[model samples]
Target chain A: MKGMTVIVKTITSWVKILIFLFGIYIILFGHLTPGGGFAGGVILASSYILIMLAYGRDFVEENLSLPAASRIDCLGAFSFAMIAILGLVFGGSFFVNFLFQKYLPGQPLNLVSAGTIPLSNIAIGLKVGASLFLVIVSLSICCKDFRPGTSVNKKKE
Target chain B: MIIFYCLLIFMLIAAIVAVETEKLLSSVICIGAIGFGASLMFLFLRAPDIAITQIVVEVLGLIILIRATISRDLTFITGDREFFEVVVSVVIVFVIFLAGIQVLQTLPDFGSPIFAQVADAPSNTYVSRGLGKTGAANLVTSVILDFRAYDTLGEATVLFTSIIGATVILRKKCRKKMEETTG
Candidate 1:
């Protein structure tokens, strides 16, 4: 997991942050833009994955560990549920746009005016990002250890 | 248009190459080319949301596919499963077959429309009143996060469940290491 050559590493260091920011832009401006939470979240995960490719899996696991990713995954799901339930509590039924209806109803085509859309986008983005990352990381781990006809990696515990 | 035809042809060629290639890694990359071509087609059709999703998901999928294939031999998955797996899969397939028959029976007749009145369809309603109701310029966002919020919720839950399943199935080696170190 020592990563690629100096050239790839340098280029990735320069470009990963930009990709991360673009993902955030997509998620935040989803109400006015073409991309939404899922797209942005995939981009976000790929930014980290780009780093993984250039700097190796150990570097990534150090920055964002497996346990921490799982935690974020849980937190993202919990926050989305909280948002939906908040709509039910404040407004009438489930998933009502409570902000647009009751509180802080702003004009259209403006940021900070999509009511609960942006909040939901952010929650979904977090959930999707963490989920994809976890899947890739776990699959990589399994693939690395499970060589054909090699049960040596497994020890009876 | 010519562009549509070109992309369609390119994708068809790429799909053929991906299927017929001898090198597994090259095949995986060709699959990625087909995905990108589809993404471009989506863009041409004025569906940028789907285009963005397609490209990113393809990138992630390509990474996973390449990683899974990079260190494998040709003889890697040739029927090394346990007897338990064999029995379980048979049961699962039988159940799914029954469910599929029931589902096919319940499906509407061919060429039947879900909505009798096109104007009353949910998409039309979303397009007409979405801007005022949700104050979002993007109709897709408003529909996904507001009108059909439950669907998004279900999607997020599905993603969560999949990650949990992956971790549970694949982390046994790490778990064993942790236990030995703790002991």
Candidate 2:
């Protein structure tokens, strides 16, 4: 849980919020941009990772928590499945695009016209972001002694 | 084309340097550079979607790989049999390269359409029909999420399963330790 010096913490505190916001923007605007669910998810996870590195694992766990991350991951996957199943029920095929109900040529360029693409993107973004954060958190837990400034005397106290 | 070849050669050099580096950290850095170069190459290939994906995936992979190496000893002794393994690997690579060249020769001209003259060429179909069919401006998104949704579903399942595996593998020992302490 012990973190780095004041410089890293200070910089990270300011920058992490921007990274998180950027990630959300990417996820939300995925249908219109180069970055989509996976890329945005990774960026989101990186923001968390930045927080973890600058503040400490204890700080991240206290705020986000490992269990919460796992739950979010499961929820993301479930939502994606639910969306797909809904498609099957309404559109007669698995993972069909049925939400927006319009597939006109010029309609595609608009933000809200892509039936299930944006929704699916959101689902994937959530899943990827949460899972990646969990993976990093779990891996960090495996190497407790590897972190810098793990004072042996502090452990005794 | 010249730029592409230049980037490719640089990538090749980076790969070789990554392999030959004695320090694991340096090797990791070299590999990351290779990945970055590759993403740039992907961009030059006119596939912005793939380039973005490549960059993000490369960074994620680099983070994980670096974390794995962080606690491990950086230096490893080169064994006597390494030479033989290298030779065998080189031979295999050469054979693959030759086979790839042969395949390329059999195919149509480079940079030309694979299905040039066909009425139902896949590229043509996707380009012409993607937006109308899926109502997504991004043709790649439409192709992935609507046209080939099943493949995407399978990919999602794979990712979910892998994460499950990671969590289970890492959680087991901690859970057992906690149980023992409580008991």
Please name the candidate that would achieve the greatest TM-score relative to the true structure: 2
Q: What is the Cα-based lDDT of residue B177 in candidate 1?
A: 76
Candidate 1 per-residue lDDT, tens place, B98-151, comes to 999999886556445445435466766787889999999999999999999999
Give candidate 2 misplaced runs (Cα > 4 Å).
Answer: A102-106, A145-157, B106-108, B175-183
Candidate 2: docking tier = acceptable
| Candidate 1 CAPRI category | medium
Report how far residue A150 has shifted in candidate 1, in Å: 4.5
Candidate with maximal lDDT? 1
Superposed on all Cα atoms, the candidates' RMSDs to the truth, in angstroms, are 5.8, 4.1
Over A28-120, each residue of candidate 1 has an lDDT whose tens digit, in order, gives 999998999999999999999998888888899999999999898898899999989999999978899898888978889899887899999
Please give the TM-score that candidate 1 achieves against the real structure: 0.83
- DockQ of every candidate structure: 0.62, 0.48
